[model samples]
Target chain A: MSKYVMKNLSDIEIIESVKRGNTADYTMIVDRYKDRAFNLLKRMLKNDMDAEEALQDSFLKAFRYLNQFREEASFSTWFYRIVYNTALSVIASKKRKIEKEMTSLEDMPELISYDREIYATVENPKDYLMRLIDKLPIKNALVLILYYIDGLSLNEISLVMDISLVNAKVLLHRSRNILRDLLLKHNYQEEIL
Target chain B: MNIDELLNDYIDGSINANKINELKELLEKDEMTAKKLKALKAIDVLMRTIDYEKAPRDFSEKFAAYLAKNRVIKKDRKDFVTPTVLSLFMVVMLCILAVSFYYSYLSINDTEMISGILLDIFNGVSFIAGNKLFHLLGASVSFIALTILYIMNETHRRFRKKIKDL
Candidate 1:
């Protein structure tokens, strides 16, 4: 099928076509997920090339194991799991520790003072917000990206991150609290509107 | 619920009218709580509205090219079936050879069917064991089988490496 026609087909339909030996149709799945999944990886890995490489590996894995995909599950959730795990493995390879092991909502860390001057370096408010998000722990960063950026639900985020739903919520709320603290310290309160 | 959860519920639009009125009452009286809510709301606005970063252009095309280049032959249970059946056949032949060797060398021949079977089996075993030409042929076949197995193993390992490398 042409890319234009393929664009309208559901992910499952595209998967079925690919399963029937229409390997060319896999581009739809790739194109559908590449950017959102890349955003997740890029935020977690903090590098474009690494994110791109991990994205490629993830797609290859998803294709290789496409037959193993369960029909009952959403392809976005399944593919995000691959992307999340791939990014984790990349971080593991680099020997960087994933921060914030706190699992409960009540386990939030004490608020620390943030440098207002640090937030002054970025003039674009969006980039500055992204920078604040980048400073979070890997899984915490991931939960935020998957939630706010990708618009995945907490349930789906939990599945992708292999954590409990409450844990996913905890990660998200904790990261948000941190980001808020940073913004407030930076005196962006009036400008946020 | 406490003020924080109430605030979250209010921000999420998950609160009932009763709780929302209660949060509003608390916001009027609570300055610290109000600041937290303000900051949290700002985060919600930015997080919801910010554009997601895009992957490089041509990502899908590059992936399609990579997929086309590496035509991955999926590993299936059927791939192992042939080897398993061949191994079973080889074991059966070895058992027949052992019986023939026992009958011809140990003098234990009894049944008419077995005696007839061993007569041909003895000839083939002796022919290979005694003649240099057949011996060379047997050695060459063994070498070729081992080489094939080795190459199969090496190919599997390299295919795995290639997948990981990319």
Candidate 2:
């Protein structure tokens, strides 16, 4: 079956199909999530090759143990858990810490508040924001991106990150504080109405 | 609490009208508070604008092949594990039964029978081990050792090649 035809199927329907011997439908699940999952894994691993390997490994592992998946949580959360864990294992094996460099004072922009409208009309807002977010610590970056960009709720974010709701909230709060501080330090403050 | 916390609470919409009024009052009074709110709003807007990374054009094709291969491996693993586990369980159960039978026989006052049975079993085992069976076991063990060494050597060579390629 064409993946586009399967695209309209809910996750449960696809899963049920795969379970009931329509094994090719598994590719639909993979196709549906590949980009979003790739982006997340890329951010987490911070290396394209590592992210690709981890993503592939995670998907394979998820398929291998699909029977163990409970319906209590959304498939995205469950699948993200697999990806998060797979990336972590690679990190652990590499024995290298994901370092967070404090943004240097020299790289700081001038201390004038840019008009909100002006910032909004910039050539590429998404690229601009991703660059700023990339400067934060991985923990903060992941939380902010997952919460704001990926549109995951606090509960889902906690599940995906294997953290408590309180921790997720705290991380989010701290990330915003850090981003704001970074902006202020760089004089990239936006004008408030 | 702190202004940052308050601002965050406000932006998250976790604050009620009273709290919102207080925040608005702070924003109106403190230029810094207003700027901070704007900075946060920018963050929100910018974040939502970010796009998901596009998967490679051939990702679906490659991933489907990977999944197909993975399924075969999974099937093989399942086939292997079930029989292996059943065999192990049977072996364990037989050992337990033999031990129980031995103990129950011991509970009897017949030390001679027990000794006779044990000697017979030992003789039978020794006869087998002393004959062609011993030679066959030695050959099999040596073969296994050679196979392991070959595998290890190949693995080491592959590892070195990989590092060199890198």
Top model by DockQ, which number?
1
**For every model shown, what is its TM-score relative to the native structure?**
0.70, 0.66
Candidate 2: give the clashing pairs.
Answer: A111-A187
| Cand. 2 Cα-lDDT | 0.75
lDDT of 2 by residue, A74-93 (tens): 99889988987887788889
Summarize candidate 2's per-residue lDDT along B1-166 as a digit string, tens digits: 7888889888888888888888888989998888778887777666777788776778888877876675543331234786899999999999999999899876878888878989999998899888997889989999999999999989998996567445
lDDT of 1: 0.79
> Considering summed lDDT, which 10 consecutive residues are worst modelled in model 2 chain A?
A103-112
Best by lDDT: 1
List residue ranges in candidate 2 displaced over 4 A: A1-5, A98-125, A186-193, B70-166
